[model samples]
Target: MNHWLTAPILIPLLGGILQVFMGYAPISLRRTLAIATTVLTLVSTIVLLVLASDDAYRLYAFGNWQPPFGIVLVLDRLAALMLVLTAVLALFCHLFAIGGTDEGNRQFHSLFLFQLLGLNIAFLTGDLFNLFVAFEVLLIASYGLLMHGGGRARTVPGLHYVVLNLVGSAVFLIAVGMIYSVTGTLNMADLAQKIPTVTGENLSIVKAGGMMLLVVFALKAALIPLCFWLPKAYARATAPVAALFAVMTKVGVYAILRVFMLIFGNDAGTLANLGMDWLFPLALITLTMGVIGALGADNLKTLVAWQVIISVGTLLAPIALGSTAGISAALFYLLSSTWTVGGLFLVADMVAQQRGSAKDKIVTAPRMRNRTFLSVLFLLGAVAAAGLPPLSGFFAKLLILQSAMAGPQMAWLWSVILIGGFFTLIAYSRAGSIVFWRTVDGHIEEPKPLGGNVSTAAGALIALSVVMVVLAGPISEYTDATAAQLQNPDGYLNILNTPMVGEDG
Candidate 1:
């Protein structure tokens, strides 16, 4: 059963390697292989999620080595949730790629599988070094996918994306080295156990390292000033790739929640809430910037990209509160935003394709092929993204608001969120009307048929948002339990540091 913890990662990793050898295979075969791989990964993740929900935690040791002595993987409620989400998103996005996007590049399927491999590993890893390794693996795979279609649009933003992430990687290494030098361990569980014992100069060094790690994670999460690279990079990337990349930002959020809370949280005494004072103000600014950018976006893709930033900011605002309720709200919001925003990207692409010369631009030269269908999707995606009622986003935001009321900065957080939602709704209204209703010259061109593939893929994603609303009670309860486990890290640490059965003898 413990070994099952590794299946989500191993399946895609092995699948990717097999995909590489099939370079000469037809595109359909490659698509089938990729889809099959993701489906298996999703099934494995669902099983793991179920197990984790019952068990609270599962730990796997490689090569029979124990704890900090060798590599290990952890599947807790949070990690399992993320893994299941990624697998689900990957499956649908892969289907969308098969609709036509994967044909542009021979390596898309292999790279996609490898991307899943990295994401699953990142979620499962119990060590900082392995987390960094996972980040690089996924990032390298993303670079290839971002430019799969090969255009100056992608190439230009791709370079900026590459450079920024490389720099983030460098900082990550520096931070990891600092932690290892001071605490003598890269295993997160060991670091948490050891972090409290450090004193004087070493404590300072650890604090510095922890702050640096936060910066690196913030960079990944695209916290304001560090976020300019995301819009163009995401907007230019193909729809399926961009949709999957939606989870990439949450990787940073997960790291911040997992590592920061477990390692430097209330239990750490003098080191508790080290940089939290700064996290809130910055997150609010990020929320404001994201809303402004979305409001002014000239194209639907760009608006959706800014929505990603908005989602990140919104989730973090609650997290910065550093309470169990805050974390629980953040987790729920995280799930909702990722799905809604991802769906928006897919819908925007589909609608853009049907608009001919206008593409996704706000100026509508013609009615979309499936105006009614696409309009409904766009409406659903828009309402969800805007945090309107009857969708997960509404409940997610409401939860955040409820959680934030206990915080000192409650007013500031509330104002920004409400105002941001207002602008978001306005932005969606503007884009929706132009893209779906109004025409540039007051004359609409004949609409074409939206292919079944695009509609299905995009519709599935939007439908998931609706599902989230329906399942809010169960999902929120799960997240609440997950956050409780996170706030009290004893179970996780006990599982990590306790020697395995045969090893103890």
Candidate 2:
């Protein structure tokens, strides 16, 4: 039955429903339940990661139905890695929410669980239609969470966020329809097999569908022109929600890897390497724009939001290289970037609260409470985000550079990434000094104590980032193996051809 493969998604589903029923329960109880569920999810995901490390793939077929006929869940090293990363981030975010981010919000707990549910399913699902369904689930849950506090800051951005995604959703459906119409299949494995056989006009239709889907995924990933909605929407959301959203852009990156490499990869004959040429140029531009946005941001939260876009751009650039080494490096950077940004969001919120009326604005104002502690945290985060030496980001970026050097657009990629890092360091340094290095003065309010949960949450993330730095060797090896598996989809396709147990024989 391979229940562990499905547990990540189902546990959150049941937990969210249970939370909805307990709406009238004490906040303590609701939060306790959410934390426990997230903990269980983390535990389950860890177990699956261990299993996947030993075995390349695990499949779970619902209703015991056969391939291409019924829904199935596929868990590989990449999927397991994403699930574990998501669970860890969700646990910390839930703890931060417990520290009062969920106050005055009736459905925060349930929405949090549902968000996990959607993200889990998105990572686990093996079929195209189910992937779309997972996207909707997560997007709907995000809408509620984004508007949780209900302010003009949240409301105005939320509307833009909603409209942009709605348009993305429509484009997604059209892409799905075109692919299905041409290939006569929505199952990823089936499409992988059918795509290579497509020819002439049909191949063009399939290529159009594939390209359109990339556009939709690019929108989700906050790529360049489609990325304007991310900075404001993320900056305006409450800290906990924004922290949890650190993985949202990566979801789009994941989709691109899964669909392009698996369905429209080099083996797809006429469709071999369809989008790399276009993606490479766009990815470099995205990297440039993201760094510029960070430099010009008005506040710490806005800067962190821009960092998310920068991370996306950094990841996509390597991926556009279409080499296994590039993919492996992209995977490692994805892990480091998500944790660093999520932790920074929590820190930014704490800094804002302690700054009184100054909040998180870039201009110098009053000194902050826990300035020393927050300073250290921000310093570590900046080092990581900027890819400085002795941290995970440095190694991650180094690996990408090594990979890009072997690709055709090596010079352009190297120039953009290195230059982007320089500007990012400058921006973070500027913001940090303004926020944490203020002059000692009497007008500054007495430093208020941070919530126990807030400090604990932030500390946990910092520790994780350090751990990533410490364990770089093993993590890189794992991602290398994951990329190898993705490059050869034969095993994945073979399993899809096998009948599920209890299915008529």
Candidate 3:
């Protein structure tokens, strides 16, 4: 087994436990530990990504047990990509939190690390049961983080989030049970091989289970109809926590890509391309709804939260294509949008603090102290979020458009995406004008200074969007390869079926 395959999960697990024991330590000490551990995990994931670039599968089997029976962590291009993304996002969020957000609760550092643990596991786990476990772990941690500041505003939404996820968890378990009963194994590779052979009543059960899993992932992804909780929950969360959550919806997208493509993919016989037909149309509706929500948002945080939904819709549309080009475009867009939206959340918080009584509300207030700085960051984030040109968002949308050119839904995809971008630009423009441009003549409250750590954290995330534009060539190449890797499950299944040398079965 390659020991590095376990580092992403273990590092966060150990870090959270150590911080728990250090509960009495200075906040500085805890913060330092959390950041250090996250940085280390980031390094490990980068190494794994480099290794995975060779397109080899590396599996870490628990207790040297073989596949289908042992719990395994699989290192592949996609998993490595997500691990790196999570670590990078977490590190910045951690940096931003130490600027005083962490002080809201003594257990903030611990919960944050636990959240990473769950996210990493969700990306790396090789079986369905463990994926369900990973969802529970992350959702539990999220419940705490959502209500970190503790107010009626957060409490109501947090309760809603909790109840909904609990329902999702139960559904997840039922789906897993159905799949297991029908196939006799919860290992994804085993299921992929077994699903194609299922027939009769068993086939129907498997199909129902697969669809249930889709509903669960849809809820997690915050797709329309099930996404009402996100705007409130995310809008109310502390700045750093909300920023970290920018990647949370992507977790659902990742699960859909991994499970659907690998197990229920085109090769799954009777169940081939299952749930995809529903995914594309709903994704478009989700996109439209998100744009409408953004237009109506009365606060910066709520607008950014709606942007998250828009991104999910944007991402799933391509993924629903179930083609290499479409999946590749989604992956590229995923990176750009996640980082951009996260930066926007932090920017919103900073703006809220400066605006005093007005908070993040989309109304005029006294001119902010660092008007030029915050405005610039917000503009960059807005342009990216709105998919404007000369930035990563524009390129990402271009890729999605290009991918859909030959598809039957070309006209629909083109129309919705174009219209969505136009409306997004209008929404951000309106918010920017009201908040930054239409300032009151007199000050309602004193302007607050932006902290160095806070500003740097936010700026760095936004800067990453610029970097994505510069590195578009290499990044596009990587995403293309990753998408190809996803399309070919034979490479994954063969590796899992064969035991590592010297391993005892």
Candidate 4:
């Protein structure tokens, strides 16, 4: 067993447990522990990424049991990429939280680490049952984090979030049971091998199960009709919690990519490409709705929350294409949008803090103390979020457009994405002008002082967008390779059929 394969999951679990015991300790000590653990997880995930670059599938099975019979964690380029992304986002958010947000609850660090633990498990698990388990873990942790500040604003949205996820969880279990009844296996690789052989009534059941799974993932991804819970829930959370929740949607997207492309892929005979037809149209509609929401939003945090849906729509449209190029483009855009939006959430919070009672509303207020600095950060985020040139978003969207050139829905994809971006640009411009440029011409109110830790945290995340642009060549190549790896399911499926080294078959 590769012990490192478990590091991402274990580190966070251990950290959260330790944090629970340290509930009475000084906040500084708890913060130190959480940051140290996250940094360690980041290093481990980066190492895994380098190891996975060799294009080999490594599995860590529990209790000496092989896949299809034991719980396992699978490592590949895609999982590694997600792990690193989560850790990076969590580190910055944790830094910002310690600056003051942690004061909201004594167990804040504990809940935060547990949330990371859940996200890491969702990415690394090798079977459908464990995936469901991962969802519950994260959702439970998120329940506490979302309600950390404990006000009616967080309470109402948090209630909706909890209830919706509970429904999703039930649906997820039913779908898993249905699939298991038909295939006698829940391991992803085992299902991939067996799904092709299912026929008649069993095949129909499997198909229904697959569609049910799509519904659950769609809800998690906050796609269209199921997305209404996101804007309010996200906008009401404390900044650090909201920023971390940015990657929560991607977990659903990742599941779609892993399950659909591997189990119900082209080789699945009667069930091949099971949900692709529905995914494409829904993705486009989600994009349109997201931009519309942004246009109508009256608060900065709400606008950023809407942008998350926009990013989701942007990501899934490419992914729904199910081509190597399309998947690659989506991966690049995923990194760009996740970091950018996470930064924007932090920036929104900072701006709201300085505005006193106005608190992130779009209406004009006295000019802020750090007006120039905050405006610049907000501008950089706006440029990237709007897909303007010389930033990661521009390149990511360009790649998506290029990938769609040969698809049947090329025109639809092109029109929706480009127009969505245009509207996004206008929305941000309106907010920016009202908040930063059109401030009241009078003595500035006693704005709160910005903390170095929070400012650095937000700035670093936005700066990554510039770094992504600079490293686009190698990053694109990596995503391209990951996409190729995803397309070849044989590499993933062979894990169950192959024998472990130096062990009996």
How does model 1 score by TM-score?
0.97
Q: Compose the digit string of candidate 3's lDDT tens values, residues 41-150.
A: 89988999898999998888888778888898888899989988889999999999989889857788989999999999999999999999999999899999998999
TM-score of each: 0.97, 0.98, 0.98, 0.98
Residue 112, candidate 3: Cα error in Å is: 0.1
lDDT of 4 by residue, 200-300 (tens): 89989999999999999999999988999999999999999999999999999999999999999999899999989999999999999999999999999
Decreasing lDDT order of the candidates: 4, 3, 2, 1
Highest lDDT against the true fold, candidate: 4
Give the alpha carbon lDDT tens digit for every residue of 236-287 in model 1. Answer: 9999999999999999999998898888887776788778888898999999
Candidate 4 local lDDT, residue 171:
96
Query: What lDDT, from 0 to 1, does candidate 3 have?
Result: 0.92
Candidate 4 wrongly placed segments (more than 4 Å): 443-445, 501-505
Which residue pairs does candidate 1 place in steric collision? none
RMSD of each: 1.6, 1.4, 1.2, 1.1
Q: How many backbone clashes does candidate 2 have?
A: 0
Deviating ranges (above 4 Å) for candidate 1:
440-449, 501-505
lDDT of 2 by residue, 266-382 (tens): 888888877878888888898899999999999999999999999999999989888899999999999999999999999999988888778889877766668899899989989
